[model samples]
Target: MVKIGVLALQGAVREHVRSVEASGAEAVVVKRKEQLDEIDGLILPGGESTTMRRLIDKYDFFDALKNFGTQGKPIFGTCAGLILLASDIVGQESAHLQLMDMKVERNAFGRQVDSFEAALEVKGIAEDFEAVFIRAPYVVEVGEDVEVLAVVNNNIVAAKQGQYLCSAFHPELTDDHRMTAYFVEMVEAAKKELAS
Candidate 1:
């Protein structure tokens, strides 16, 4: 079975852990740099991007986390996590990870009070997936390699680029496990590549 790690630095760590487990993968909460070596894939949970970034720097796991990406393992980011993976944050001067070639606008959906749920037609999933948006950041632009997965209110919310996957909505907050299952499939594929 594939082992997946959710960055436990901040945010909905337990929820993501449950989601990964529901997807039939061994879920681990990643708190230290060494823990990244043990997981087949990683999930950056939805939380305050600035806070998460500060915690990452304090733990001195910034470079280690980025290096983990270089190993070609899948990394999925949700909400503020999406902001971390983005290469650009519109109107913001700094960014975390900068792994995905996309421009994201922070809190594009307004404040926490503006949070709402909607079913979206994701490209890979057969049916509409329930998406929960809370102070989410939407992709304003994508690079050549990036594939837009799902959109809502004319905003790019779900996107994938090679081993990287991002969503402006929190999937762990809902009962649907399709997104996590989709990610597990990506992890399985990457594991196959390594074995071959």
Candidate 2:
């Protein structure tokens, strides 16, 4: 069975673990950097981006997490996680992982009270994916290799670049496991390629 690790530093760790299990994979709550070696893929869940970064640095996971992605393992980021993977962040001097070649604007969906749900037409996934956005960020731009996955109200909410997948809304917040399943498939495929 494939083990999907959810970064337990912050955000919806339990929710993502449950979702990953629902998608037919063993889930691991990755609290330490060494845990990265035991998982096939990683999920960066939604939380306060700055606080998460601080925790990552304090735990000395900053380099380990980036190396994980660089090694061709799949990574799925949602909400604040998306902010971390972005190469450029609006009004910010530097980004966290800088793994994905995209520009993201944090909290582009307004404040916490503006949180809402929308049925998104996620490309190559679902015709109508129920996504929950809470203080979400939208992709302002993406590199040529990036594929836009879903959009809402003219804002880019989901995208995939190579082994990297990200969504502005929290798919784990809902009962839908298709998004998680898709990521699991990505991991499975990457693992096969690496072995070959």
Candidate 3:
């Protein structure tokens, strides 16, 4: 079974764990740099981006994550997780990994009360899936290599960068497992290519 690790530093860890398991992959909470090497892929769940950055710096994981990405291990980020993976952000910037090449507007959709559910047409998933957005950010632009999978209100909300897939909405917050399952497939494919 593929072992997928979710960064437990903060955010929706439990929800992500459940989604990964539901997708038929082994789920592990990655709290330390050492645990990172044991997983096929890593996930950064939705939470406060600034706070998550602080926790990442406090644990000195900022560099570890960048280095891991270089190793070709797929990394998926959702919500605040998406903010961390982004290359540029319009708002606060105390700390960001600058991974994905795009600018995002944090909480661009009003406040938490502005949160809503809507059917999103996502690639690799049949039928429209209801995406849950809570204090979500919006992708203003995407890089050349980035593939936009879903959009809402003309704002980029979901994208895939190479092996990494980041979404502005929280797929874990719902019962849908298609997204996680897609990531699992990516992990398996990457492992296969690496082994060859």
Using TM-score as the measure, the top candidate is 2
What would the per-residue lDDT of candidate 2 be over residues 68-175, giving only the tens digit for each residue?
999999999999999999999999998889999999999998999999999989999999999999999999999999999999988899999999999999999989
Task: Single out the weakest 10-residue window by summed lDDT for candidate 3.
Answer: 91-100
Model 3 stretches astray by more than 4 angstroms: 92-95
Over 1-196, each residue of candidate 1 has an lDDT whose tens digit, in order, gives 9999999999999999999999999999999999998999999999999999999999998999899887899999999889999999988887789999999999999998999999999998736899999998899999999999999978899999999999999999988989999999999999899778
lDDT of each: 0.93, 0.97, 0.89
Span of ten consecutive residues with least summed lDDT in model 1: 121-130
True lDDT of residue 191, candidate 3: 79
Alpha-carbon shift of residue 164 in model 1 (angstroms):
0.3
**Top-down TM-score ranking:** 2, 1, 3
Model 2 bad stretches (over 4 Å): none
Task: Look at candidate 1 and give me any clashing residue pairs.
Answer: none
Give per-residue lDDT, candidate 2, residue 42. 99
